[model samples]
Target: MPAIVGAVKVINVSASSIFHIGDVYAMAPKSSAKTYAGGGSFNTGSGIHIQLSDSHTYVNDNDKFDQTIIGT
Candidate 1:
């Protein structure tokens, strides 16, 4: 089956909430990188988590976090 893209919107999590595994997020382009597709949240420590996609390295405070596409 074809993948379905979810609604695009900025991510708004509770103060202590964290994204779960298989959650997808979108990040705007930064520096020399283009728009990125990220997903799969993994908690590292101190309320910080990383996406499982290739754009993980480009994520930053300035980047926009939009959408939460579920499923593979």
Candidate 2:
């Protein structure tokens, strides 16, 4: 077996969400859904209403019959 006997420096490791350093198998894509409302920020007051809905897909399964609805 081998080992590092010196100091190690890591920089700019900007995953900010997901970071992998070692070997991996079957790395599925990270599922994500983002919903943003108009005029929604820290600069001003937001007067609009925000609604979110998600009928997420089944993970690690075969969806022979699947249905999803976001909104009306």
Error of 2 at 58 (Å): 30
Candidate achieving the largest lDDT? 1
User: For residue 72, what is the lDDT in candidate 1?
Assistant: 19
Clashes of 1: 0
Reference-based lDDT, residue 26, model 1 = 61
Clashes of each: 0, 0
lDDT score, residue 56, model 2?
44
Model 1: lDDT to the true structure: 0.48
In candidate 2, what are the lDDT values of residues 7-39, reduced to their tens digit?
Answer: 556665543344444555644433334444333
lDDT of each: 0.48, 0.44
Q: How close is candidate 1 to the true structure, as a TM-score?
A: 0.16
Root-mean-square deviation (CA) per prediction: 17.8, 13.0
Instruction: Quote the lDDT for 28 in model 2.
Output: 42
Alpha-carbon shift of residue 70 in model 2 (angstroms): 18
